[model samples]
Target: MLYFIAPFIGWFVSGIIKFIINYIRFGEEAKKRIGNGGFPSTHTTIMTTTTLLIGLAEGFLSPIFGLAVAVTYIIIIDATGLRMHVGKHAYILNRLERTNKGETTEALRESMGHTKVEILGGLILGTILAFTLNIIFKV
Candidate 1:
């Protein structure tokens, strides 16, 4: 229960703070923050937070912690690698489609993965939440 709550707290905090900051700095450009792939990656936030909470609860050297790390590594890699790759392709295709005028009815999704700064934001948020939850719940 603690692990579940901890990760969610991290996700919420990261999303809210990033949204507000982006809104302030970028104005309407910050609209991207409302969707996927923006200043902070919510997927990374949730995954990292869960991993850290697991590690804190299970002991850093424990098998569970190792498993958590491995799983998180794969997830983060996918978010930054394959997911970003796909998103880039989508952006390209969408731009190309725009040239076709009425040929395409739907727009492709451009936001799918996090930039380095976005990933870092998630990591920081997750770490803070993990520590806070650990202290509060003594997990």
Candidate 2:
């Protein structure tokens, strides 16, 4: 049960935190726009949570735990590297698509990736949440 729900918990909590942060930093306009690229990447949070939970439930030396760690590493790397570049490209394209009159004909989404700090934030949150849950439920 814990394994099944840990990722969801991590995602929901990370998303709530991201939403609150966005609201505080960008105001109501941020609320009007719903997209990714925020502090504490939910993708990282869920993967980290899954990895940690697997390490806890199955021994850290177990093959499944090793697989979980590998998957988590891949996810984190993808979020910080490739996806980040994609977001940057989207930003540039969006700017390029703007007309002389300051009206954008078509705007590309720029929230496709997570920054390093965002990934770190997710890592920390996931670690804490996983340990807490493990302690409480012994899973």
Q: Give the poorly placed runs of model 1, Cα more than 4 Å off.
A: 28-32
Q: After superposing candidate 2 on the true structure, give the runs of residues whose Cα lies further than 4 Å from its correct spot.
A: 100-106
Whole-model lDDT values for every prediction? 0.80, 0.86
- The number of clashing residue pairs in each candidate reads 0, 0
Question: Model 1: per-residue lDDT, tens digit, 7-97?
Answer: 6687788779878888898898787547667767777778788888888778899998898888878877888898899899999999889
Candidate No. with top lDDT: 2
TM-score of each: 0.87, 0.91
Task: For candidate 2, write residues 1-139 as lDDT tens digits.
Answer: 8889999999999888988988898898667445567888899899888889889989999999999999999998888888889999988887777735665575777888888888899999999999999998988
Model 1, residue 32: distance off in Å is 5.2
Q: What TM value does model 1 have?
A: 0.87
